[model samples]
Structures are given as structure tokens and as C-alpha cells.
Target: MKTQKNFRPFVAAIAAALLGGALAGCAPLLVGGAAVGTALMVTDRRTSGAQIDDEAIELRSASRLREAFGDRAHINVNSYNRQVLLTGEVPSEAAKQQAEQIVGRVDNVRGIVNELAVMAPTTLPQRSGDTLITGKVRASFVDASDLQANAFRVVTERGSVYLMGRVSQREADRATSIARQIAGVQRVVRIFEVVDATDLRQLAPVSTGTPATVAPAPAPAPAAAPAGGAVVTPVR
Candidate 1:
């Protein structure tokens, strides 16, 4: 049960992000004079295999959620390296917990970070503002010389920015510092998988344009993320 430190009362997301249950799917990666769009298979840290497993996990979880709750919830599922992070809204605490449980049962899901808020879903304007905030944070990441824009995945709910990725402690701290300073951001929630050089080999290989027509993947192996688990940075 996590909470936004100083988040405002309202928030929202882009309609396109609604697909695959990944709220705000991938934010517009606005880098130096270029917008590389959202899906960055080539540069992503997750192995091409893990990335696909994440997508399946999200879709399966979303489908089950829809069957179980329907319009009763507005939940977003984001999985990185087989770890699923739940965000957005649910009608009650019970619904929230239930949502997490349902996703936990999905195939290939190795971990769950439950960040679902217990309340009503966000309105259109709030979602729009969230989209705007995500863009700002993304641009800030790109503008910072020390940061690689795609290394962090940004998801904004209301005015709270949820950053998900595999990064080092310094990168995490630097990204957190930048996110908390944004104009519309009232809180920064970091869901980073902190790792060092030795941890590199444990990750999935870089994406190599594997076709969707490729054969179904085997079950996801145990996560190689460090033993401390997801670094839950204090919401600032």
C-alpha cells in the first residue's frame, strides 16, 4: 500500500496508452532533436525475450482484470524483466488487492509492485495532464547529459510520476532529482531495478527484432535483479 507524497487530487492518461494495459504505453521519447516514439526494442535493457514476456503478462493480466471487474477499476499493468508494477485506480482496497492477486497468477510474472490507488478513476482532463507531465519528465531525462532517455520508463498518474527501469543508484538518484523538480509533478515514485556490471549478463539480450510470429516463449526464468528487490525510493 503506497501513497503519493504530495500529489494533487486529480490526474489522467493518454487514450493510446490504454492498449496492452500499459497505461500511457510508452511516453514519447523526446531526445536531441528527435522523437523516437515509444517502443524502443533496440535500446531497451530487458532481453528481447523478457520484453515479450512482459507484454504477454500485461495483456493476460489486463484481460483477467476486465473479466473480473470490468468498469469497476482503472488499472494499468507495467512489467519490466518479468516484474509487474500496478498503477492507476480501483474502487476499493479489496479490489486493489484482488487486482494484484489476479496479476500474480498470470503466466511468466515473477514479481509484483502494487501501486494501485483506492479511489475513483481519473477524469479525461486529469489523464491529459498526466500525459503532459510524462512528456515533460521524458524531455528532462533526455536533456540531462548524464542520463539516457530510454533507460527510464515514465508513467504519470494525475501529477505523480512513476519511473520504471533498470538503472544504477546514481542514475536512479539523478532521475529522481530531475523528476521531482518538474513543473506539474507533485510526487516522484521510482520503480527501478538497480544493478552493476556483474548484473549485466543476467539480463535478457538486447532486442534483435524478433518477429511476433516467432514461436511462443518458454516460461520466464527467475529474475536476476539484485537481492534487495525493487528499490522503492521515498516519494519526494
Candidate 2:
């Protein structure tokens, strides 16, 4: 009877150990899934529109990148999910390399994919307002074309517009005019490299990607202000 009692205790210990090992194996997967879900939720809550939010972030990052390079004369920035894609013409390979370096240094960037053309700098205003104009024109293109819509990225820095992706020159030209027509648009910049217009696809948002279905992560409270006013970019 004492042996039987001791056996029962050993069995219980073995069971516990197995259970612990199983949970340990699942822990990393669970943690990873939670983190990804949290990030997506945070991204969704922070922006009013996903595409618009992406464009704004891209524009802002592009501006910062150009400034950082100190050669804002050329270059356009497009952002999708923290990945920045630069497309446009630069005067030299050195300049092209510099643009990549500058964009990589920006905070929150997952990666930089530069498609900047190395050629004579085309006449385009690389100003903030110009980039805005470019975005407006791209929006018009989306409204008019039967294309997947999100397949194209439009970026304007100054008055120059850079269109990136596998788009026809006709499509790019149309996009350019759209930007030029917008008010406060000084000049229209075109840095589009035309290619086969096919093979573009847009990823459908997850079935549960809807705002209400996913709960946003709770943001920490803001820190106390320093002795002097300091400027900080909002996460959104």
C-alpha cells in the first residue's frame, strides 16, 4: 500500500512535467501572435483610413529623408506598413546611394526599397506642398482607373511627383496631369519607370481587420513636459 501511494505521487509529477513542457513549446508562438495582432490593431486605430494613413506617413518620412540628405532637390517617398519605397531620378549614383542611407536612418522604418533612377535631375519641385499635389493626382487616378487602385504609389516632394511601380507611361502621364491641376501645386514632377502594367495585386485586409472586430492596444500616458517646449511627432 505504501508503494502504491508513492507510485501515485510519481505519476502526478510526471504528468505535471509533460503539461509544463507542452505549454512551454506553445509560449513563443502565442507571444508572437499576440504581438503581431497588437501591432495591427494599433496601426488600424491610429489612422482614419489605412491607405491615406500610409500615404501621409510615407510623405512625412520622405520629407524627413530628403532633409536628412540635405539634397531635397530630388527624391520621393512612399510608405506601406513602415516600409518606405523611394522612386525618382537622382543626378548621380552617389546621390542615389545617399538617398537610401538617409531613409534607412529614419525611426520606425522596417526597411528601405529604393527605385530611384540615376540620371540627370529632372525639373521638379521637391517641396512638401508639391508632394501633396502628387498624392491628390494619384487619388484621381485611382478614382478613374479600373486598376487594383492601391497598386500604384504616388509621392511628391516639393513640386515634383514620383510614381512607382509597374505602370504604363500613359497611366503615369495621366497621374502627372492630375497632380498639376491641383491648387498650390507649383510644378509636376514625374519619376515613373514604366513597365508591364500587369501582375499587380492588392492584398485583402483580414476578415477580422475591421476596426470594431479588433481592439486597439492601450497606449501609455504621455510623459511630463520638460522645462522647455519640445516637438515630438505623433505615432499616427
Candidate 3:
């Protein structure tokens, strides 16, 4: 009976693996849809309009890429605050440039960072390993006390990690350090739009009844006397 119990667990694991494989194709769509819905309701730094634009940029870019490259390339389009990061494999340098050009034309794309390697497409197993590495890196960020984990986006291709977001220099550096410490991460790339902490503060909406700081106007130059005018000064 003990032997049978152990065998049953193994059988259950095998069945679970099979089920996962069967559903693998729908996983990204489901996860991405859920994340987008949740993010809209959360405290993300991006304004709701900017978030919507970023999503539109990603979708448009993907559609354009499909029309241009079809199955000849493996491209992953990630847009954060309208800055797009392109990662994956293309067949040639020409194709790489073409891909970037295509994405650049997408409306609302403020910038593009093309990190597509000029190589053959990676196998499914290799892609799965990269996904695992990305998950580990993301988990580490969540565990980090100093980092706002959602302030960064993590993408892993092969063994290289790509980080994207609008963040202060400190946050970007901290995130890069965390990703580098993960095993199987051979490289870390920063595609962040680095901003000052003050900039972030300025972007935040002022709370009710909070006074806004205004610069003092320069003292009005003493009223210029007419060419030969009276020297009497106005009373203060």
C-alpha cells in the first residue's frame, strides 16, 4: 500500500505535466489579460491614459511585425510608458533593422530599443528556461525591500535579462543588481528611462488642500524714468 501511494503521486505529477503542456498556448494571453486589468486598478506610476497607450503600441507593433516578418522572426514586443523593447531572434541584420523600423512607425511609440539577436530562433526548451529565469528574477525583485517591484519590467531571452520602465537611477541600479544575482542570467540590459526622484515627485498629483510651490517673481525693475525724467522713486 505504501508503494502504491508513492506510485500514485508520480502518476498524478505526470498527469499534471500533461495538462500544463496542453494549456501552455493559452497561458500568456490569460496572464497578460489579467495583469492588464489589475494594473489599471492599481497604483502604477503611469497615468491611465499612458497605460492604455502603451498597450495600444504593443498591440499595433505586434500586428505590424506579423505583416512584415511573418514566421521568419521571433520577436517579443514589450512597451512600458510608450518606450518599446524588442527582444528575440531575426535571421539577418537587415531583418533586425526592418523590425525596428516597423515598430518605430507604431503610433505612440516614443522610443525603441532593438535587442534582437541575429540568429536562428531558439528552441521551445530554451525559451522555457528563459521564462524560468525571468520568473526567478521577478520574484527576487518582489522580495527586495527597497524596490517597487512593479516599477520594473523583466524580460529574459536565452540567458540575457532586459529591464524596462520609467524609474529613478537608484531603482534601476537596484533592479539590475538583483537580476544579475540570479543564476542562469548571463547578461543584464537596462532600457530604462532614468528620471530623478524629484521628477517622480512632480508627476504625482498634489493632494487636496496642499499648497503648490511657486517661484517668487523677480522684483520689478525700478520704474524707468523717462529719458530725462523725474528721479523720485515710488514708495515701497
Top TM-score model: 1
Q: What value of lDDT does candidate 1 attain over all alpha carbons?
A: 0.63
Compared with the true structure, what per-residue lDDT tens digits does model 3 show for residues 1-236? 99998676445534433333321111221111113556433656666666777768777777788888878888887776666667788999999999889887888766666777899888888987776676677667766899886676667777877766557767766776677777887766666656668976665521222111112223322222221111111112
Cα displacement (Å) at residue 67, model 2: 3.1
Error of 3 at 229 (Å): 57
**Which has the higher TM-score value, candidate number 2 or candidate number 3?**
3
Residue 42 C-alpha lDDT in model 3: 69
lDDT of 1 by residue, 148-188 (tens): 87777777776877777777767777898888787788666
User: How many residue pairs clash per model?
Assistant: 6, 9, 0
Error of 1 at 150 (Å): 1.0
Per-residue error at 41 for model 1, in Å? 2.5
Tell me the TM-score of model 2: 0.35
Query: By the lDDT metric, which is better: model 1 or model 2?
Result: 1
User: Tens digit of lDDT per residue, candidate 2, span 1-236?
Assistant: 99998676445534533332321111100110111234443433223244444544555555665555545335546544444556556777887788777766665555555656776544533333443454455445555654433334444433434444334445554554454565655444333334334521222231211111111213322111111111111122
Error of 1 at 56 (Å): 0.5
RMSD of 2: 23.6
**Best model number under lDDT:** 1
